[model samples]
Target: MVGAMSLRPRILSSFVGDRFLHSTPPLHQLFRYNPGSKHVTLQLSRTLSGLTNLLFNRRNLDELSNNKRKSLKPGKVSPRRPVPGHILRPPYVKSKQPPGIASGPEVHDEKGVEFMRASGRLAAQVLEYAGTLVKPGITTDEIDQAVHQMIIDNGAYPSPLGYGGFPKSVCTSVNECICHGIPDSRALEDGDIINIDVTVYLNGYHGDTSATFFCGDVDEEARQLVQVTKECLYKAILICAPGVDFKKIGKTIHDHADKYHYGVVRQFVGHGVGRAFHADPVILHFRNNDAGRMMLNQTFTIEPMLTIGSSNPLMWDDDWTVVTEDGSLSAQFEHTILITQDGAEILTQC
Candidate 1:
């Protein structure tokens, strides 16, 4: 159970005149989602856009020159498509506005637990189906289209769609891009690595999970990084139990990543998810001052992003995509988890 001290403050603060909507980053700027009309609007800066464009083009040119071959850059944004009539869309999707953030983590009762189980299972199934499509010469937009239809066929909504203005159903982040990489028309080449993040809104709740997949034949360094990244998630999950300091999750992850000389991304942390796509008790991936405690019935996620170079990430002009500052390879894995009477239950596990 969440301590009494933890419950009241969060609930009260969350309900105090829509401040929660303004305080937290609109939607999952770090993970996924666009803000509702009620949220604060960020003004686009022309100067910033110009600088970003220059840097982006320079980076692409450098990559092409180094390889002595053409490398693909993310293409034009895909147009939004409509969900099937039978699938239930999220409030944000229906209203085209920001869905207010959840006040706190949901302490699932008997019924709530079952809903989460079903949601997690469906999300995993969708991710598995999408994984089969990863190969040389396929555009990410095509991948998104397949995933979108699959979720609709199952009578579930692709959580990322229209949530915070994300154009695609699934997130397809490629090499050098840490997370939140939007799906585009870029054709994946042989030896490239991509991370497919899938989250589905089903039965009134959301289940989020992601995994890094290799294209054709990946190099030794890339393979090891992906394997180690998965191990980091497993080791962090091992530390989850009642009364354990939440900060230890970061410590354990950092320890494992450090041993291999890999960098852990700090800009984005795993978050609580349920009725609201993202919620309270933000889970950091690096050791820090957060002292929150895990308790029974609390549901959250622990998705760690690891890079082969600098952990620092830079935001692209588009504001949603995040890439490594040093342009090194990155890999990530995510699972929605629930705190139980004895240990953590991995709801998103297939």
Candidate 2:
């Protein structure tokens, strides 16, 4: 599963600390949460000169010539769907809150690896079916319904349904949304791009995967952003192995994003996934000096977020949806992987 990286100091807890990974980006703005206040405050940092010029690729020019379109708005979310009694729910489902990331890496035994592979395959199959329903006029809620049914039919649970009170069975991030978008009643429009994040729990293990898809008649600029974002994920995955430093994943993604002048989002990152949805060591998608190493039999995820404009995010009121501050287009891709003896095996593949 993917989550926003925050540096807020907090008392250590099983669930709380894992969600608060630390990182400091050269962001033009910073977000601060005021506990007494209901919402997070968006604080401005020193502006980077020529940033506008730097982000003004073909996408920005096209938006200017055509006049910018409306930013993403929240649609009416349907009531929480119910799972069958026969399906076993994750422990966090009892609390209706996510148990924070697990303490250590998700290192598994040989038999445990097989369980992981089962869940990962189901997640990939579900995600593939979800992508097929991405045509214009189809509401994201419809997609969620189809996905929810398929997972249950396979005797698996939809991992996102109740974790931290997430309302949807799957995350449907459309257009500028960076991550954690809830599926709602809004219909997909022509030329829109979307990211579908799917995770499933089966036989006591969790599998996570996601992909960005296009609606009818998408523009070349958005298409390029989606393609490059996907390439960044694969490029990062290729460098992963038993002894590889975790920082190399960030470097691999950051360097490739730099080549196209795209912005690599720093707030959200990948994590260890297996028995629990999110675990450690925290995987950063941008360049940094985080000192962590991969080990054999370890399983985790590598997801990257890339944007055509400002990488800074503006969180919506629901506290789940994350969108680009400048309303620029963003795209992401993710997969769960296992560190094998020679290299890494992508578990979340069909």
Candidate 3:
């Protein structure tokens, strides 16, 4: 098959905080590691300025030694709409409210958000279960099996399972991999870090979530990357609300990561996911993102994939897994949220 397409180019600041990442041309290279493993590190330069990219040199992984790197046909998505997205399954359907939540603030179409709440709770449950399922001998495929049934048992569907023909239900991105890591026969080893990206479909709507967790004993850098990446997600949320500039979110997140000299991956972005798996109002986590206004009722995921060295990612031949260009550990956290009259409600909440 043809390689995965390169996404639209983006504009980002020169320095996230102290690490001046501004170069007229993005620095790209291929870094090598274990010959039998798919976990290669990268030394990527920030490539988030502009919207046009050639299909052949997507992330420009020239410095790395991997020959399988190639551009992909970018996935097609709706950029904006009056309403954000939903999880209510069988699309174009309504909700059946539960008890207390129905009488609360979400009365008229208010309870409609419950599906997201349910997705969040279940996602948390799944995260909890998946974390427990990790071990030195367990395979990623086993992890996927557990995550898949957890959704079914909760009367929900795994959103990633056929999303744009994505083969897995949960994204299991291990060390050195940025995001979109598919489950495989690979077993966990000592001191490994894996990030699980989960999205559930409930009541016709969608709930998106992701968290990087420790597999066994991790390195100091790995621990810091996971903690700071998650902190960046929450910090980005703090700057989110109605009428807020979308670019500031990235600026704040990048600034925060820069303080630690962390690398913020620029390849993939958090997007609107609700009634549809992925929706309008794409949320970019780096500065200079050409994002529009964050109007009321707008919903999206604010996931920032941070790298240890630089924020560049290169795709493998399978056209899915994305690894850091600098060969450093990467961690990310995501939340599906909605913009309220005041702040924002994390729909995937308990």
Clashes of each: 6, 1, 39
Question: By the TM-score metric, which is better: model 1 or model 3?
Answer: 1
Residue lDDT tens for model 3, 1-350: 22121221222211010011111223222222222343333323446222212211123344433533232222222221111233224332232210100111111145656656666678777876788888887877788888877777777777666544456678888887777787877777778888888877777766778888887777676798799988999888887888888888889887887777666665455666556554444455766545467867766778888876545555565656777655557788888777888888776544
For all predicted structures, in order, the TM-scores are 0.81, 0.87, 0.71
- Residues 221-282, model 1: lDDT tens digits: 78999999999999999889888898999999988887787777765668778877877777
Top candidate (lDDT):
2
The pairs that clash in candidate 1 are 33-164, 34-163, 34-164, 35-98, 36-97, 36-98
Model 3 C-alpha RMSD to native: 11.7
Candidate 3 stretches with Cα past 4 Å from truth are: 1-108, 289-291
lDDT of residue 333 for candidate 3 = 88
What's the residue-level lDDT of 252 in candidate 1?
A: 93
Displacement of the residue 89 alpha carbon in candidate 1, Å = 1.7
Using TM-score as the measure, name the better of candidate 2 and candidate 3. 2
For candidate 3, the lDDT comes to 0.61
Candidate 1 segments whose C-alpha is farther than 4 A from its true place:
1-72, 95-101
lDDT of 2 by residue, 137-198 (tens): 99999999999999999999998888777888999999988788889999999999999999
